[model samples]
Target: MSRTIFCKKLQKDAEGIGFKPFPGELGERIYDNISQEAWQMWLEHQTMLINEKRLSLMDEDTQKYLADQMDKFLFGGDYDKADGYVPEGK
Candidate 1:
């Protein structure tokens, strides 16, 4: 059976990642608090941010920005949205 976590993002128990998806303390925190569903949502949001902002993974600044966004998206008050993006059928 899959593991479940008390998801910080969703504020409920949900399916969890089998391993840490990122590195360090923050990653450990995520593994302990975030659900697989919330992580997938973040992945979609991150993709939009990367595409709309033309961010380069090779740049340290871009990496830092994404990491900050990830933390905010998961645990902070202000979640980032891709500027000018409208969901399909919205």
Candidate 2:
């Protein structure tokens, strides 16, 4: 499935597992407010993105951040993982 489609399914699955998407952007925004540990964890996941090709089932920006993180790690390698935020593709 395409990125967006996959992400929607992923979120739906997460909800099924009892994790709601943040109540709103405020509950999710972390750019400059995340703890250092969280940031490091994000970076570690980014490394996985660079090492693998599985698309995330999260929102668009989150998916993009993964791609960018992978790019940074891989030295500008191409990333085709789906942008899973928008629910357009299926």
Candidate 3:
């Protein structure tokens, strides 16, 4: 059976991810608090950030920036958005 958590991002109880999505303390926090659906939303947003900003994963600064953005996206409730992006079907 799948585990459920009170997902911080979604603000409701939902199915939890199978494992830690990242390393260290943040990963543990996410594992305990974030749901799979919320995590998938973050993944899609992160991809948009990477593509829009032309970020390189190999760069240390880029990694830090992404981490900061991830924190805000997951918990801070003030996440950034891709510049000039317009949702489909307006």
Per-residue C-alpha lDDT of model 2 across residues 1-90, encoded as one tens digit per residue: 211111221122111212222344422433223333343444555545544545454669766666455434333345444344332353
TM-score of 2: 0.29
Worst 10 residues of 3 by lDDT: 74-83
Tell me the TM-score of each prediction against the true structure.
0.93, 0.29, 0.92
lDDT of 1 by residue, 1-90 (tens): 689889999999999978899999989998999999999999999998999888999999999999999999998668678779986689
Ranking by lDDT: 3, 1, 2
lDDT-best of 1 and 3? 3
Off by over 4 Å in 2: 1-32, 54-90
lDDT over C-alpha atoms for residue 15 of model 3: 100
Give per-residue lDDT, candidate 2, residue 85: 33
Error of 2 at 36 (Å): 0.3
lDDT of each: 0.90, 0.39, 0.91
Model 2 pairs whose backbones collide: 3-82, 59-85, 60-85
Ranking 2 against 3 by TM-score, winner: 3
lDDT for model 1: 0.90
Question: RMSD of model 1, in Å?
Answer: 1.1
Error of 2 at 38 (Å): 0.2
lDDT of 1 at 71: 95
